[model samples]
Target: MSTSSTGVLVLLGAPLGNPEDASPRVASELVRADVIAAEDTRRLQRLLRELGVSTSAAITSYFEGNESGRTEPLIEQLYDGKRVAVITDGGMPSVSDPGYRLVRAAIDAGFTVTAAPGASAVTTALALSGLPCDRFCFEGFAPRKDGERRRLFASLAEERRTMVFFESPRRVADVLRAMAAAFGGERSAALCRELTKTHEEIRRGGLGELAAGAESDPPRGEITLVVEGWGGPDPEDATPEALAAAVARLEAAGTDRKAAMKEVASRFGVPRREVYDSLIDRD
Candidate 1:
């Protein structure tokens, strides 16, 4: 539990939204460490105030903008055998945040690294998603640009394991729309917003419905989206009728007819002409 004995770096997982979620060991490290590297010093200060814990540790800002520059100096402190604790504003350090570089540097310099585990939004959202959690993958954040986002979802169209993603409130609708286009409108998904917070909302439905809901009332606060993966047989194994049906479903969900055909073609491992022909014949 003591960090001052050697070149030890403690990575503490702060509460996602609730201050009470912080563990007792994390509070101890926050107060007793020689140096504290925080993603947002103001937020860290707020957390300390909420916990009513005081620390004599030297606090330094270590975020995306300065994490690289701060890594060397923090590593030096660790090399000097000073206890250094890394903490993010929410969730675990280095988890879609700024602790990877410092942790890697400390390990390279033979400093021991440890963690004070606490609440995680990823697992929390996953459990609340009500999707199959037996096998799942966390996609840190979806791309911002529409093209990039569509391509990303297109690439994962065949993924069988449940997929989790962190998205901004601004792009929630766009992400959902792209997901519907690539994975079909009937694909199950859950949108978890402001998790563990006062206004937490979990909207469960097909991608199309969720996208429309987000468009109508853009959600605020942190957003985590959980999507059901391709649990059935491979797309290539699907019948011609099935491929046509997929395209029709996407088109019905607001996807362009041609775009839906293209996505279905790519997903089903069939030629674009074949998909188009099937849809045309059915029509």
Candidate 2:
């Protein structure tokens, strides 16, 4: 397509960590674009410096906070026959960044959108995770609230494909705890931190074990968690009724009945009320 043609978006992938990881096509597009929409202009400049590529394109900020307001100006530039290239601080734009809105706007405006794919933590971690990769789902980040996080993990308890998630260091332990409770304490998983960086670390173990490890020392840097799919429930495990009886036993052992029922409900993947009703039905 001609450089001056309206409605064209060039999505370029920024370097994940190693500057050499930037693709040749991405460099070419960055140099040739008429307008560059970058998540961080300083980071973009640094990337260009690292790659030895010079760009004189009019650069504008496009990030999470202002993406909505900036989409119009970007679309206007595209409509005015300027080739607009969008890049995030690292990784491909819009995968977990703020470029989706502008891309969608451009598409609705009949623009041609294309990408120069490069490094991604999602696939990078998945490949390094030692988990099944044939089929997988990327859940970027779980809800922060405990109740919401629990519900979110609970809904995915039966997912068959390997699951990947992005989590911050601060909440990694809590997230692991919730995953352990929802997916089973023994579910195998990999926690990949700081992929492609010098201090990169990968911890592989059961969810409960990982949670305990995180408790000892919270992880640092970006993290990608890869969890194995459900292994099917144990056939010989206690039934719901039997589980209620066990809860009663725990209560008789001095545990609060309500709390015991809640724990049983979580372990058995049922509602607390259901476990309570089971206990009543047994009585």
Candidate 3:
């Protein structure tokens, strides 16, 4: 697809670890590229070698730091109708990675943009998480700062869909600890590390349990976290035990017993008397 005015901008998904996992289409397209914009030139070289495909395409760096400056040149190639392929260190481009700019630029410039999809740590972790993957949201990476990360977790506390995030191994423990506080200790989650690599490990447990384990061992390598979403405390699931726990949680947050009972009653459509009985039973 190399020509003068109908240049196509292709987003290629690189293998997560095992190069043999790459699809045949990706290999063929790499050979067809007139310009290959890679997040890391060295990784690109290794991938090319492993795939055993030779390319005469002009290779250039396209990463977070140089995206703005590098995009126009790549767009120029596309404008010239040259087949341009964008590939990151791994996974599909334009994700939490740096290919979004080029994709947007190409679309804005009226160039056709497409993809040869492959492995993704997000979906991979979700599938392995054993959580409800029917509907989920990818949160990318949580903020590094404690306050910011906690705030982000709190905001997602009520989200009903499953959530995914990428995190650094160094901060996984802290993030899990914060998640337990914001999302509750019993919230189910999975910590997928070094995915698609030889040392790939997946740790599945409640947020509290994982946080405790991480503190002692501190996992290594790339980390992707899949967290169970908030299912919400609805009236239908309001068993006496559930109601009491909910009220106690509210009271612990400084709500008075009477008000907490009242709120729980209103929320669950249960009698204030039942809520009171549950609290009394706790005592």
Candidate 4:
């Protein structure tokens, strides 16, 4: 185990699908950690077996079900000068995974925080999707409920940057259909399935075409979707009221106020300061 002073919170990114894609540093971090916060303990075990590594670190379950409740004890571990490592089943923790609360808590508690970088479905798909990677946003997983999902889709309708989304095999077609309705069928997009593994596939087409194809032949793997941005005129024109309104929509959908404002700014192609000013004008 690595020497510990004030302790550290290591947010380790496990492989998305192929464990071999994991960085060399992952094995070393696995060894150095005093406590490992695994999103799926069984999955972590499989990963360890794949990597030919072993650790005596205490393993703890830290998935969505108990993320909030589990934060405090993890913080206490940090207080005790423990090298806490968080490894999700795939990708980086906190990007549509459990680890944000612990990270924020560690920062608030004045403990050092770091990450062992690894392959990400988000970037990997974006790179291979033939979409505009210069500006893009990860939308995480779309809402399961159609109403909320449609609302989210509508809220992002004006988003001009390339967009990426994660979806389950069961819901991939459903979300594609919803996107067809909200973003229109003609919107260009790519469906990247089983990325970085055997049987990996990247199907590119318009939203409508993809929706039809997915319905006819449902995808059967972890899916990451990359979509082209709006081709029409800028939605907000960076107006103060409109900027505030856009941020409000995202906040109403459970996004933090600051993050909502930042997203609004990115979508509208305006300075973040303008989004903040818009909020002030709203009051």
Per-candidate RMSD, Å: 5.6, 6.3, 5.0, 7.4
Task: Residues 65-119, candidate 2: write the lDDT tens digits.
Answer: 9999999999998889988999997888998887999888988999999999999
| TM-score of every candidate relative to the true structure | 0.84, 0.84, 0.84, 0.81
Task: Give me the displacement of residue 60 in model 3, in angstroms.
Answer: 0.4
lDDT of 1 by residue, 125-211 (tens): 999999999999999998887767766786677688999999999888888999998888889999998888889899999999999
Residue pairs in steric clash, candidate 2?
none
**Residue by residue across 208-275, what tens digits does model 4's lDDT show?**
99999998999988899999998643654668877887777677667899899888787778889989
- TM-score, prediction 2: 0.84
Better of 1 and 2 by TM-score: 2
Q: Is candidate 2 or 3 superior in lDDT?
A: 3
Residue 232 displacement in candidate 1 (angstroms): 1.7
Model 1 steric clash pairs: none
Off by over 4 Å in 3: 234-283
lDDT computed for candidate 4: 0.90
Q: Give the least accurate 10-residue stretch of model 4, judged by summed lDDT.
A: 230-239
Give the Cα error of residue 143 in candidate 4, in Å.
1.6
Ten-residue stretch with the least lDDT total in model 3: 246-255
Ranking by TM-score: 2, 3, 1, 4
Q: How many residue pairs clash in each candidate?
A: 0, 0, 0, 0
Clash number for candidate 1: 0
